[model samples]
Target chain A: MTFALLARCGRTGRIGLAIASEDLCTGAVFAHALRSNTGGSVTLGGSPGRNNTLACNLLAQGYAPARVLQELRANDPQCESRQIAVIDRHGRVAAHTGEALTRSALHRIEPGFAVLAGAAVKPSLVEALVQSFTASAALELDERLLKALESAAAECATPPRSVGIVAFGNQDYSDVDLRVDLHGDAIRELRRTYDEYQPFAAYYLERGKHPRQAIPQREFADMLYAGRSGNTR
Target chain B: MTYSIVARCPRTGRFGVGTATFSIACGRRNESVRANVGISKSQAFYDRATDPLVLNLLAQGYTPQYALGVLEAQDPDFQYRQLGIIDRAGTIGVHTGRDIGPWAGHAIGPQCVAFGNGLAGPQVVEGILGGFMAEPDAALEDRLLRAIEGGRDAGGQASNGQPRPERSAWLCVVDRGEHPLLDLRVDLHDRAVSQLRRVFEACDRGHLRVDTR
Candidate 1:
């Protein structure tokens, strides 16, 4: 019903996750990120919201990704029906796929990233996700995660209805949090949204941190337009 | 309390709305948009239900004027509300009630309508239309974004002798799907329009990398 990729940027230590699902608001329910410099978690299948919160709390408490998964499996009564993925601050990853899931359920873990899928998602889709993510190592964490999700969605039998991507930078808040809660073609919409949001990420960071000196948005747009016109000449 | 633009893209048949205000979460209570149907917005002494109701009526094949009429007939506080509607065919309807206060007005253009209350002046609506029409070949989302920026540049909302900061802003566009093609918002910020601009620009640049540790 859902597929996701979680990864950490080797250079910046930023952790991010991208997910798509047939269900509505998958990002709101399944994805959780700890504060800046910490790791993140995603919980799918049964009791996702509670499991995700517990995982994040554990990650915040300095527990390793493997230890977080162990804690979840030991405490959750319905762990057999759940799929969980955790990535720690050091880019180490761990994942769990329950036996109660369908035969297609699977996951793959690499050095700095992990890919997981719930029931109805084929193993081939997971493979595509891993390959896509691994091949895009030179890109930013957000783009790498999104490209992996896009590749998996392209291989999926049914198109997803919702998609979300989140990346935590050095700030206390997420650097990028884009979600298409519901759409007939959620992955495409998410891509479009992500593309449109890319240029201003640093600008927003600047404005958030230094409100007085940063120029206005209209002024920024004018500057860009002027610069483009100048270059053409 | 807010200035907004509701429009239908002639080239793509997409519907879009952009709004900015002195309040927080202005988009949550002010916008109702359905793909391949129409777009609606309610502001001033805003009612959250008016937008969806107008969109519902448009989906049922009613005219934008008829939808406005329905709202006027049903709501006892209609006089305090400002509303705008654009149907799938690009027909637009707008109302600025008597009780909406100073600088309340609206402007109707080729395929869109700009409306607001508690604004700086009529220039705000005029600037919105001007900005939208300036870029005929741009994407609907981009055009709507510029339209709101134009409004902000023209003056935006004001009270007493001072201009009020745009505390919140939102841009939404819908294509042929049940959900929106793009829904971006900046809430509870002093310079929400600029913040929204940054978000919109980031969507295009695709270069948001994490800072080095």
Candidate 2:
């Protein structure tokens, strides 16, 4: 089982998700699709399929959060065993946890946030996500998402084998996207990976949009430098 | 930048080193193993000459300490290099340069010496030592992996307060051919340990490349 959050920052027009599980390479299975700054979807658990497009269309049709859930519930026959959550560009949040969920399964929905867990997680993790996300106002979206995962894991007193973070900022691409395939300490690994990717995030974004003028001439000289294989003295 | 353990099984005669670092391709930079002779981890502001020098000294049938001492005597800035080694006979030695980074030290155990520099705390070395000392009967590869895991858990190398996952991790074992039975490396990965483990698991199965040379 797994736990995840699909969120949109009202102030920044960004959307993202933070997820963790006992699985390997969670990104491959869980990340349905993202529509740049429009929204993102997390499709997971119990024979899940790509429902993110459904969510996007529902949002575009101007359905409220409750109506979005009701529409999705009526459309899919296998919806009972699935867990899906979403945040539209306008920051409306909604989620669905199947009635078949075990007692441990839990989920929460706020105005601009949704935290949902599969059968393997306790309800307390949802609380941890909310509290940590609220407390981490000063951090970047990626770091805030990570803090939420750390908080949930800490409260549960057991970390997952794999953790993934995916965020969409002003650009159509993810500003910070990473995965800890498996580790004894996935949170620390995730944090390290995020830090490494952070320095290159904006450079790559600018490079994508304005390939010629994006990077400084001096810095780009160093950037294009290739390192040799072994120590040379 | 890192710490490591180079050891012999004493039973199977297999030799190996388990190491982690903030630097890239640490195995290629710091560790050198001469088949049936010995293994060494020379690191932290690493000097390129150390790997060959250690291998040459071991080839000449020198003890770990005398060999390192002779190597240090030839180098003017010997105080900056950190090293730990074990010979075929299981003779062990460790050296930390006086001018090396803070939290640098070594802990000697039977058949192995675990040492680290720029570590988070003293426990980093202790954990490597304790893990190696425990389960003495396990395969050398398993034991080495365990030691590195312990080292990370206790606090692996870092200039800051809490130790973070390293940028690279390496594990290598040599058979009688002096060729690596397994030489798996996570040269620069966020989940270095985990990636190395996956590579190790694949190499451990009959899925290994036997160096022909």
Candidate 3:
């Protein structure tokens, strides 16, 4: 019913997650990121909403990804129905797919990222996500996450109802947070939205921090629409 | 160069504007909303000040048509401007300046006015109206988002046998307070309207927040 990837960018120390689900508003319930850049976490299946926050809190307290997973399994009575993934600030990755998940449920833990899918997701989809993320090391963290998600979504048997991607940079807030809460073609829509947002990612970060110094949004649009360099300032 | 929709939700008395353009920041200079008063969008050789002025006029109990008349009488460059104005009473006024360029037009719908200049065709504005009217029972922000997406899908800005992409887009909705209920902008993007939709969805689901300040 849900698939997710949690990753930390080795180059920039940014942590992010991309997720899709047959359920509605999956990102709102499953995706969690620590503002302090401690790491990112995603919990799918039963009791995800609560465990997601708990994982983030433990990560913020300097718990390793494995230790965080252990705590989650120990505390939750229905851990067998849940799938969890955590990526710490050090780029360490850990994931769990409970025995009660669908037979196709699978997970892959790579160098700096973890991929987890449960109930209706195939092992091939997990492989595709990891492969795409690993091959796109040159791209930005958000781009890699999106690309990986796109790849995995393409392999899905049925289109998801909702999809979300989030990335936290040096700032306290998420640098990139895009989602399609309920769409027939959520992954495609998410990809289109991400492409449209990529150019403004840095501009938004600048505006968030130094709004007075940054060019006004309107002026910036005017410059870009005119085919002039918007970065001239 | 731009397409815009300015609307007042009759049920909630909320005002909103959805706009996109080949130019950047279409909402910043083009859109204005005054909570209980009305909403205005001034584009096509736009004067950023005009939107607030129109809203101020609406706040003072002037009709949207009268406000347009005031702008026509006062602004020397009025011939180069396009505008869509809607009052709290759901009264609508729109102008597509003759000098704004080819395919410029506007469509007045129930509680909404869609207008654009340098568009692919008249269908762009019509598409906006259709999209807004398509979902009357939907949330105001969702309707506005769909309206702009409608415009983009109907062929947005004009091109030379090539597809013209919207580089910037914005959607804003204001209710009772001095602050807006929703304000999202894509300062620059190839698929500006689509990006705006993404942001709107995130904000709608509480996954993202737009700094109103």
Candidate 4:
């Protein structure tokens, strides 16, 4: 299973995740993003529930980086089987990858950002994604995240037949937002979906997609969660 | 350059020619041949005047060997060029021009055949033939890949010295038991090919994998 996701929450935060696995329907297991006052975690190849709880708890306690990871390690039995990256509302970041990962897997943590990628990935992909963020001029954080995923996909000599990416951010209650998921030739399809929906830059964003009324969270969620084939666009 | 092609009409069991050389647009030339029943002389190959006409005569039920015999009776200098075909009933025929490139040849079989030119030697054709013969169950796409790979390994196009990284390549297979288009060209380099493939696959998935209702 391979998946790519991008989400933006008001101006408070941005998050991205890409995970590939030979297992069918792996997307339903890995790739979890949750953001609240405390912080958020972009967890891949790990327990979705435990990871989500730890992230929510850390944010609740105002914990950041190493402190949150240390607490997570203390509680989890198979810490090495998980790959987790977290960034809070304050731009603090931390990541961890268990030593039990296959030889083909690894993680990288840097200032204010981290990349946890593996499963038949070239070593250069991680570094390229991280470096491109600083050098590329993306209008939004989500854009940068998508570009990073594209770079990773293109770096492979023989790219895996499947690839995916995910990005999410916490938005203030008043800010406009969107969430997108896509698969297949990850970069091409992702860009296509972005252009077709024009979600981030939609004129309706400021108006909240309503001419004379404010769209409630439940209504927007209903619209966002409706799953239709990309062809429906 | 020399090349060959064979395909069966989906509605009728009629097999036809679908390959050409001289430039990259063999797809176009193959179309013209499809209207008629057999191989045609290269527009520029002057000496071989009525090769296509001969093949059409054979399509009327003459033996491939007899068909080539008739063409030989007309043009004694036929071996100087290259053309080949296998009709619907396992009938086979081939022609090689003396003026054609060195070491060009072909071998026909019940279901397929191998042909090539500008190769290291006749063994290149042999290698392609062997590859097709070895993989009986492979889809035509895979068989084409094996044949092309075999030709490449056997010194494809004699002048291809240093590996001139191919800008593009194509693979196609037409068999009677399935759709006329089994697997269309997958030009990994062309944005159009991948983009079109994505759209088609998405449509296919939408129709076959998901609940339309």
Predicted structure with the largest TM-score when compared to the true one: 1
Model 1: runs farther than 4 Å from truth? Answer: A219-233, B1-213
Q: For candidate 3, write residues A66-90 as lDDT tens digits.
A: 9999999999989888888888889
Selected candidate, larger TM-score, 2 vs 3: 3
**DockQ by candidate, in order:** 0.03, 0.01, 0.04, 0.01
When sorted by lDDT, best at the front, the candidate numbers are 1, 3, 2, 4
Order by TM-score, highest first = 1, 3, 2, 4
- What overall lDDT goes with each candidate model? 0.76, 0.69, 0.75, 0.46
DockQ of 2: 0.01
| Sequence-dependent TM-score of model 4 | 0.41
Candidate 4 Cα lDDT to native: 0.46
**Poorest 10 consecutive residues by lDDT, candidate 2 chain B:** B203-212
Task: Output the lDDT of residue A90, model 4.
Answer: 62
lDDT of 2 by residue, B119-161 (tens): 8878999999887877897778888988998898787876646
Off by over 4 Å in 3: A208-216, A226-233, B1-213
Q: Give the Å shift of residue A84 in candidate 4.
A: 1.7
**A-chain TM-score, model 3:** 0.87
Per-candidate TM vs. native?
A: 0.53, 0.49, 0.53, 0.41
Q: What is the interface RMSD of each candidate, in Å?
A: 12.4, 16.0, 11.4, 25.4
Q: What's the distance in Å from true for residue B97, model 2?
A: 48
Q: What share of the reference contacts survives in each candidate?
A: 0.00, 0.00, 0.00, 0.00
Candidate 4: regions farther than 4 A off: A1-32, A157-183, A199-209, A212-233, B1-213
